[model samples]
Target: MGTAAVSIEHLGYRYPRQSNIFTDLNLQIEAGERFGIFGPNGAGKTTLMHCMTGLLSFQQGKLSLFGNDIATNKKETNKLFGFVPQDFSFYQELSPVQNLEFFGAWCGLNKQAIKQRTTELLEILGLADVRNKQVQKFSGGMKRRVNLAIGVIHDPRILFLDEPTVGVDIQTRNAIINYLKELNKSGTTLIYTSHQLSEAEELCNKIALIEAGEIIAHNTLDNLLSEHKEDGLEGLYLNLTGKAYRDGNV
Candidate 1:
């Protein structure tokens, strides 16, 4: 079998002056699969992404990206994935073209290649007309598109998205989803987390539902649906986590 796109084993983590954030977490995301992680606000989904991408450290267990251990091969592993964080990670002052050029250079793409990709992404993401305008001045949806464009500048094999379509117009959301579908269709693996269960249902073939830092369930969407006898992800989540509202930092 091919090496998994991402693999985590017996993972454990804790925050300063707090109890364990998660313990005994384990998952494997195969290549070409759209994998989703769903949970309440503080379920540690984003934290897990940080650990997988080397943004944060954990106390125990192991994570690997395409067979490269993140703990021991950080740089090599980083080259295998792209991450779109929940918050905007790019400079607000920079124009879309400039931001893409800078990030493309950081990804080691030559000048011509950067220009080509910048133009293509701008057009494909519907930002061509505003490519020269400062991102801070753009609408929420436009900024979201810019964020997505930056994450995909290098076209990495795997993409990690954290609530990527949040707070956007339906048009922009659809555009983003369509682009992501095209990417996954072309064999780019996806690791997605969001409160948008309906969207997740449409996007992910496999999922791991987490609560209180524990994986309550994990499997293919079809299998999970059958096992839980739930018609939708939202129903399954409610069945598993109850109806209480959760509060935590995004």
Candidate 2:
């Protein structure tokens, strides 16, 4: 059998002077799967993604990508995955082409490669017309597209997305979703987290529902719905995690 795209065993994490964030967490995601991690505010969904991507340190457990231990092979493992955070990661003053050029270089691409990729992404993501405009002047949907383009600039084998389509028009949302689907079809494993349950249902083939830092449910979307007797992800989520308004930093 081939190695899993991502694997975590006995993971534990907590901030200083706080209660445990999560403990004994374990998960495995195979390649070429659109995997969604869904949870309410402050449920540690983002934190878990951070741990997987090495953005935050964890106190215990092991993380691996494609069978290589992350701790021991941080550089090697890092090259295989890309993270598109919720916030804008590019410099606001830079044009999209300039931003892509800088990030592409950071990702170790040659100048020619960077130019080609920048052109391709701009065209495919509908940013070609505004390629030279500063990102700060773009709309939210345009900014989100820029965020996505940067994340995949290196053409990573595994892509991690946190609230990728949080605030955007339906047209932009559809565009991003369709592009993500294309990435998956081309063999990029996707690990995503979001509060948009309906969108999650549409994008993910596999689902893991987290609550209070614990994975309460994990299965294929169809199997989860059928087994829990819930018609949709929202129903399953509310049924399991409760409908009370969760108060925490999103």
Candidate 3:
């Protein structure tokens, strides 16, 4: 099998003064697979991403990328993936170009290389028209695009997105999804979580349904559909999660 793009074994986590979030969680994403992680609120979907990206530290178990432990390799392993969080992660006061330049430098790109990559990304993300406008003035969709551009400036091999297309117009959403499709076609493995099941169905071939920090079901889209025979991802999701109210923020 191809080297695992992401691997987690016996992983566990908890917050101060609260109950444990994960206990002995295990998961693996193969290279070149567009893997989708799904769960209701409080399911630990975002938490898992944070742990994978080194945003949060776990006291137990192992998390690795390309066989290198993230906790051990730190900087080197970080360079292998990109992240676009659910919230806007760029400097709102800076223009798209300025933000890209600053973040590109943070990613360790040199002057010429940073400048070159910035130009290319701005063009590709359709931000060239307003590259100089301060990001704070842009619409939600526009800002989301800028966030995506900054996230991929270095062209990471594996991209992790937490609701990357949330709160955007349909047109903007389509633009972002299409761009991501092209990127994945070029061989970037994707790890994503989103509420838009239809959108996820369009892009992801493999999926893992998580609840309370544990994976309850994992398989390719076809297999999942065949096994449950639900109408779609949403149907399967509701079937697995049930009809009870979920305060995901908890």
Candidate 4:
């Protein structure tokens, strides 16, 4: 196996008003691995992602991306990852091609390269016909596909997606998941957090079950099943996380 694409050691985080969200978290994701992070709301799933991408600064612990320290080598670490946020926003008036061109330029790709890559990505994501249509006119599924294409246009080695299919129709969700599987098969390391246990079962080779700001379990799907002697991930999740309400006040 190749070197670990992401390594976290004794990582911890906290907000000024809230106590520590994650404590003493250690994880290593190998290259080309499709890893899933499953957690209830407020379990620090997104917080951990921020720390991994160097978006949030933590005083304690170490984080490395592709062997480079994320804290000390921010630029190099960021360049090695592509982030697809849950709530993807783009210019409503611009077409898919235009939006991709702008982001591609920002990534330092030349005009010709940007155009070629945009065309290829749109086609691959089944957005070729709508490439010229304004994003505001597209359906939710189309928009998600466009968002994914933009994220992968630069071809980074690692991809981070936080709930990429939160509120969409079943067909759209399936399409998005299928595309993600293709990306993984083609050698892009994927790390994502999802509430959909069934989808995670289908796509993730390894999973981390986190709750109450701590990781309760982390292992391959087969091992997790064998250890728990459960039939599915949902059973294991409920067994570990419980069914109690985790209500929060804003």
Candidate 5:
């Protein structure tokens, strides 16, 4: 059998002086799957992604990437995935080319490789005209594209995206979604979290619904809808997690 793309076993996490955010969470995502993690605001969806990407440390259990222990082989595992956080993760003052150069270097790409990759991403993401322009002057959609380009510079096997297309026009959103679909088609395992249920339905083959830091539902989108007798992700989400205010900022 092939190794799972992401494996979480009895995963637990909490911050100091705070109650447990989540405990005993277990999930397995297979390679080449477009997987979505959906939940209400403050439901620990971002926190779970952070843990998986090694941005935040967990207090218990195991996280593995393709069968390698992340805790034990942090360096090795780090090279296997890329994380595109919800926030702008690049230097706004820098040009897209500059940001890619810096990030590509950080990922161990040499001068020639960085130059080639930077050009490819600029053209592919529609940033070729503004390749040398500072990112701060670009529109929200352009900035989002830059952020995504930086994340995948090294072409990691797994990509962890947190709200990769937040606050953009429908056209830009569609462009990003199409690019992501092509990436997934090329065999990159995607672990994504977003409030866009309709977008999630369009992108993800499997879905996991979380509330209060726990996974309440996990299955293929079709199976989840069928088993719960719901028509779509929204119905399944509300049916499983309720309509109460979350009151969480995690």
Candidate 6:
């Protein structure tokens, strides 16, 4: 197996008003691996991502990014990963190229490299025409593509994506997935959360099912199916987490 790009051991977290979100969660993702996180709406997937990124503190467990403990060196550790959040938040008035340029600058990329990468990313994401258009006027799919480009501009070794295709169209979704696959093939490790089981099945080599802040299952896709004797991820998810209503105020 390749070296681990990210590692989490005995991770536990809780919110003041909320119950424990995660407990004794242990996971390791190796370089060039594509892993998916699946769970119900209230399964604490986002919370786990926050904890991994060191945006939120956890009571126990250790999280390491690129072999450095996140708790002790959060700033340096965070630099080893790229994050694409569920929501696309950017300067609405800025064009796609301009936004990428600004973020690349913040990431400390040289002007020539930023310009070249921006061009390549825009073309790859099929946003070439809209590269100069203001983000405020773009569609949801377009905005999501731009969000992805920004996340990967610095080319971090590992990537974290939270429901990346949530609001995108089928065409854009496929495009994004293909690009991510290419990145993985080129040595980038990916960890993402998704509600789309089919997408997860096609893109993820392994999966971790989280429910009520705990990992109910973790293994390769085929192993999970064989162990549970389930037809697919959706069936496995229902069997593990159940179909009970999880209605709660967000």
Please give the CA lDDT of all the candidate structures. Answer: 0.92, 0.93, 0.92, 0.87, 0.92, 0.89
Candidate order by lDDT, highest to lowest? 2, 5, 3, 1, 6, 4
Clashes of each: 0, 0, 1, 0, 0, 0
Q: Write the residue-wise lDDT of candidate 3 on 159-207 in tens digits.
A: 9999999999999999999999898988899999999999999989999
Better of 1 and 4 by lDDT: 1
lDDT of 2 at 223: 98
Candidate 3 least-lDDT 10 residues: 241-250
TM-score for each model? 0.97, 0.98, 0.98, 0.95, 0.97, 0.95
Quality of model 4 by C-alpha lDDT: 0.87
lDDT of 5 at 63: 96
| Model 6: per-residue Cα lDDT over 1-250, one tens digit each | 6558888999988888877778788988777789998888878888888988788999999999878999999778877888999888578899999999999988778999999999999999989998899999999999999999999998988899988899788999999999999999988889999988999988999989887777889999999999999988889889998989875446
Collision pairs in model 2: none
True-structure lDDT of candidate 5: 0.92
Off by over 4 Å in 4: none
The regions of model 2 sitting more than 4 angstroms off are none
lDDT of candidate 4 over 1-250, digit per residue (tens): 6679999999888877877877788899998989999877878888899899888998689999889999899988887888888876578699999999998887677999999999898887788998899999988878888788888888878999888888778887888888888888888899989888898998899999888777889999999998999989999998888998766424
- Candidate 1 lDDT at 209 equals 87
* Candidate 1 displacement at residue 213 in angstroms: 1.3
Q: 1-250 in candidate 2: lDDT tens per residue?
A: 6899999999999988888888899999998999999988899998899999988889999999999888788889889998899999999899999999999998889999999999999999999999999999999999999999999999999999999998999999999999999999999999999888889989999999998899999999999999989999999999989989999843
1-250: candidate 5 lDDT, tens digit per residue: 5899999999999978898988899999999999999988888898899889887889999999999898888888998998898999999999999999999998888999999989988899999999999999999999999999999998889999999999999999999999999999999999999989999999999999888888888989999999999998898888998888877754
Cα lDDT of model 6 overall?
0.89
